[model samples]
Target: MAELYFLIYVIVFIVGAVSGLLYSYSIHLEPFVVKEKFNIPILIMAIIGWIFTLNFSLFSMIPSFILISIGVFLIGFVIDMRPGYGRKETIIGMIISILIWLITHCVIL
Candidate 1:
């Protein structure tokens, strides 16, 4: 039962990682490889956190999303505190993943 819910997160993680790799491109920011590495991983973690909280009704999703966003950003902030870490891509991916999750649960089937 609970294992099935965790399986959802595994799928989401794979999707996030594949997207990060598939869309890797050069940008004036840091580097796209950083996006594939740091960005996607953080997004994966965020999604997993969201999925775990999803045990509750949709009413709790909004708050779960808020916390997930905060946690991801805080992680990016801390990671960026170190030199050579890319926060921009991490934040971007985090936003994108969360939006997709929100819409899937809140809007579309």
Candidate 2:
């Protein structure tokens, strides 16, 4: 459906924006803490949206599922990058995220 494609496009745009926003040395962007509770609303919203679309003839739920998965992965990435976290853990987290992203796209999209 068009909504699925739209969500996929939005996700790609968001990742690109995040990459640039999180790494702007000229702007002196500082990393901030992201509490686990902060993501709960988004998680709930995604799930609700997916459930709402289940019987509808409009949006497909696959892209929303993928989006929510990536959002969770990004939260993990932020946690792993926080102070006192080991570099190995950050690397592993990123690797796992990449795998999940690839598998989700392959299996769902």
Candidate 3:
């Protein structure tokens, strides 16, 4: 059962990352060029998502979504604040994460 939940978490995280990547492209962020640049931040966000899933419960869906969204946003915001990176790719990532959470929430319920 635990393994199944972890697998679901992994799938959700991948979908979120893909969503973020597509969004970045739409916004002209040139994801392919910046792929190496944002790898750490994306990994951090995935870890956050993993932790969230570990404690996730149906009744706490709204709060969980909010937390995950904030986590993604912060990861982006922090990375943007760094010296070299200027664009707000983190916002795009947050959108992807929120979308994933919403979709999975609906499916699970």
lDDT to native, each model: 0.46, 0.42, 0.49
The top-ranked prediction according to TM-score is 3
Per-residue lDDT tens digits for candidate 3, residues 3-100, read 77556545555555556655545555543444345546555655454334433453364676555444444443333343334343444444555666
TM-score of 1: 0.32
Give the per-residue lDDT digits (tens) of candidate 1, residues 1-109. 7676456545555554444333332232453334235555545644544443332244464665444343433333323332434455455545665676688777886
Of 1 and 3, the candidate ranking higher by lDDT? 3
Q: Return the lDDT, model 2, position 47.
A: 38
Model 1 clash pairs are: none
RMSD of each: 11.1, 10.3, 11.8
What TM-score against the true fold does each predicted structure earn?
0.32, 0.26, 0.35
Better of 1 and 2 by lDDT: 1
Clashes of each: 0, 0, 0
What digit string (tens of lDDT, one per residue) describes model 2 on residues 5-104?
A: 6676566545644543443332343465333333343334333333322322223654555554454434433333334322333344446545555566
